[model samples]
Target chain A: MAKMNMLQAINSALAIAMEENENACVFGEDVGAFGGVFRATSGLQEKFGKDRVFNTPLVEQGILGFANGLAAQGTLAIPEIQFADYIFPAFDQIVNETAKFRFRSGNEFNVGNLVIRTPYGGGIHGGLYHSQSPEAYFAHTPGLKLVFPRNAYQAKGLLAASLESNDPVIFFEPKRLYRASVGDVPEGKYTIPLGKAEIVQQGTDITLLAWGAQVEMLEKAAEMASKDGISCEIIDLRTVAPWDVETVSQSVIKTGRLVVSQEAPLTGGFASEIAATIQDECFLHLESPIERVCGLDTPYPLAHEKEYMADHLKVYEAIKRSINY
Target chain B: MAKLLNVDNPNNTSKNDTLNLEFVDEHALAIPTFKMLDDNGELYKDAQASSMDKETAIRIYETMRFIRVFDERMLAAQRQGRVSFYMQCLGEEAAVTGSAAALEDKDMIFAQYREQAALAYRGFTLEQFMHQNFSNEKDFGKGRQMPIHYGSKGLNYSTISSPLGTQIPQAAGYAYGQKLKGDKACTICYFGEGAASEGDFHAGLNMAAVHSAPTLFFARNNGYAISTPASEQFKGDGIAVRAVGYGMKALRVDGVDVLAVYEAVKKAREFAVENNAPVLIESIAYRLAAHSSSDDPTGYREKEEEETFRANCPIERFRRYMLKQGWLDEAEDEAAKEKIKADVLSALKVAEKVAKPALEEIVTDVYEDVPLHLQKQYEQLKQHILKYPEAYPATASRIEETK
Candidate 1:
């Protein structure tokens, strides 16, 4: 097992997938030569050749639509939309067509095998446009599967599985944690099941559900809470669409109290959904109403970096609120 | 009479004494419109005209009737709120169905929003159309798309897109693939004249011309883009004129005349396959209906103006010519209409009644498999449905039934 950062792990996965499947091609602005704006797809163009891995014109819609056409015609096209916030130009392709391709064509035509690999999330000083968790927008659409990997191991495993999937996937890597999170990633063509949850730590008192950059935030909060005797059970939901209900349910049932956390806005955010589920599945088991600690309901604010993020303090606050309740 | 350009047929280099019009030159830029079966429903003394028996002519007419009837029924369904929205190609049937008829079944099509006639002509079942309109489980589209955006792999029709001209470039690229494979198939992309204004249109046409991809860029110049008429849309004569600038073959056809459209497209498809060259066809036509069910055409265009277009209806014109030829009679026309009306109505009823796709489908196609967070999100929605039964009563009822 080789220990590497999340960005390096993602790069390794892209390299391995392209090496294994001749059909697996990656295209985006600055993805080739420059590696990527974030270096997640770094060194791929040189390794795979420009024909296999290259840069495309800055038309997001064209990039995605071309990818869809290629994927439909039997190529595993993985397009990078550069940033999560900038994906709106290509939103229609993903939401209206790519997501719904299988269902819309009555399964007669399916490009269920394309991956839109994008770097998402705030916390880095990238500002409003560059740093957004637009997973909610994708989650709102029916046909799309959403993935948000936390660290190196999950990044490589989940991305490899996504590339191999016979469905269109939005593989969102947290830009903030691209270098921040590190873990041992097993080499070779390994795949993690898409809708499975990983229990990072066991706890007897409370279930802390989170993912992506927020999962790292939860770990820090959990460390802080442990000093005060709160055994926080942390569940990292690596995938967003078709998420692991069984894992979340079991954890909530065992812990009796649930605290969901995310860096996205509080209202209609990913955490709100998780908190709602706990209320339904383990309402009887709950010692409290499920509490959610999320980013404030506002456009991600600039100049208020610490105030905007659902960091350790917010996670700890939510845990306290759930415990007290 | 306007003096037409005289030049070589850009689509075909063969030296023939076809009338060289003003629009053409020795360089062969103009698109040659062919009509072996004249408007008088008489077959001209052309050696290239295919032998079309009464059966084939009747089949074509019946398909046109079916499409018109289906469009009318869908409009009614939309009015009843059984479906959300609809766009009817009421006056432009020949441009769609005729081109579809001219091609081999294996050839691919990339359509803009209004070319439902292509789907109908290609044997996309009435049930599939209804299912797509109503978004039922039986709908191959899985109740996921907005109404009228039809796609069928079996028919080789790339799904219709809402974005104007996006399919144009995509078709060119797809045709490039076909060229690379040395396949007999060419890609036919249909869009309205309004969509031709988008950059994708120029890009697609220029790319196809440069790459020598087998593609036919069919522009249905229906005279209006919602409220913006062609005069305001472009200063050029029509979309056909742009083909010359791209150094590709171009044509202008009496879009109402099904025979002209059919003959032109047949030769265009042939040229595309043989030389890997592209063709731009400007179909001169009018929109006899509102842009969509939501649009109020009376706000922009006069009722009398629309009345004039309705008078010169494509179906009516084609019907008259077909009847004059003694190929179609009153009885057959009525029978075809009655059968299509019944089929469309029955399919609509059946399709509307079918259940919507399961909620699990919402997350399934996003990846090769459902991811963890999405599973959680799915469960959360399920839980929300369970918890707040009053808010989503329909989903709650579905859940209860599933249980």
Candidate 2:
């Protein structure tokens, strides 16, 4: 095991998947010879020929639709959208066409193996245009699977699984953690089951559900709260859609308190669903109302990034409030 | 300015006829206009038709009649709240069923939302149709999809999507795969004239041309797209003209004439397989019915417009031709009509009585296995259903049975 950043893990995963399967190809705006804007698909074109890995036009809809066609024709496509906020133009293609093709066509024709990888979330001031957590928007869709990685180990595992699986996956890599977060990942090929939750730290006082960059913030908050004698159990929900509700519900029942966290708008955010589900399934087990520490219900503000977005302090406060109640 | 060259031997060409000289091989429209059977229902002496035996032609006619009756009854059912919505091909049945009849059964069909006639011709049972529209358990797609998005794996027809031209490019990609597999089967993607305005249509055609994929882009050029007329849609001759720009083969046929559509598609399919190329056929017809059960055509288009199209209905034209050929009897036609209507109504009754899809379906098929997160979501939804029993009484009561 060796410590590696999110970018290293993602790059490692791409290299492994491509080496294993000749059909796997990666394409995006600047993802070819130049690697990518963020270098996530770095060193791909040098390794695989340009036909398999190349640049596409600026049309987001074209990239997704064309990839769907390619994937349908026995190619494992991993197209990048550059950023999560700019993915709307391709939303109809991803949500309506890619997600529903298998179910709608009764599996007569399916775009079974495809991964749409892109960087998401806010920490290093990406502003409204570049730093929106758009996972919930796709989570509402039926056929597509949504996965976000909090660290390098899960990043490699989830990316590998996405490449191997016969389903379209939206792999949201947290932009800030592309270099910030690091962990020891096995050099050998591995796959973490999608829709599973991991418990980062064990505690008994309260359950803290978080994902992506927020997992780092949650760990920091849990550490801060530990000094104050509020032992918070931290659960990183790596995959948002089709979430591991059993693990979350069990934790909530044991702790008898829940605090959901995410860097998206409070209303209709993923945490809203988590809170509603916790209330419904573990209502009798709860010691207090399920509280959510989420980004403000507004466009991600430009001037006040730290205040507007949910972070370590906000999560710490939400947990304290739930405990005090 | 680019000079136009006289290819008919410029030195010997007479000055008077030079400007209008017919070149042996000049760039002109390559689309073949077909005429296999005449208006009086007489088979043409020069042009040979498909070897469709008497039995097969009659079977095709029966399927067309079935679709006509099914559309009419479903429209009436929607008005009575038996179904929520419907789109009918009241006048353009031939364009759909005829082309479908010409194809091999193993070929895949990617359809826009309005081509129920294709499904009906391909052996989609009336009960299956009703179950899909009503979202019953017996529906193969489960109840996850909206009404009219029917898909059947048993039959190679893809589920219809509401998006205008998504299937166009998808068909190209799917056909490319079929070519790789060395399958004789090709993919047929159907869309309307309105869908042609979308960028995906152009991309699909261009890709199909570039790759030489075996695909047929069947354009149902119904006079109107929703309420937008064909005149406003393009300044070109029609969709067939655009095919030439893509450097592909093309044709235009009288969609209301079932024989014409059948012959054009059959020839086009052969051309596609032989040359490993794509063919675009524009079938010019009119929608005598409104766009959908949800649409009120009276506001945008006039009833007089519908009257003009109703006069040239495909079924009526086919029936006239069949009678002239002495292949159809008035009493036999009347009996067939009665039987189709009875069949559709009884099928609807039985299908609607069937149970809704099991609750677990909500968590299945997104992947090979339902992941842990969706399982949690399902459990949560179940708990929510239990809490609000009145909101989903049937679902709540049926949860135990589903599990």
lDDT of 1 by residue, A70-148 (tens): 9998888999977788787687888888988889788999887699999888876444455678888888888788998
Quote the B-chain TM-score, candidate 1. Answer: 0.88
Considering chain A alone, what is the TM-score of candidate 2?
A: 0.98
The candidate that wins on TM-score is 2
lDDT by residue (B334-395, candidate 1, tens digit) is: 88788888888888888877877665655566568887866775675565456556644435
- After superposition, which runs of candidate 2 have C-alpha atoms over 4 Å from their true positions? A1-325, B1-33, B36-51
Docking class of 2: incorrect
Mark the 10 consecutive residues where model 2 chain A has the least summed lDDT. Answer: A298-307
Residue B93, candidate 2: C-alpha displacement in angstroms? 0.7
Q: What is the Cα-based TM-score of model 2?
A: 0.57
Fraction of native Cα contacts reproduced by each candidate? 0.00, 0.00
TM-score of each: 0.55, 0.57
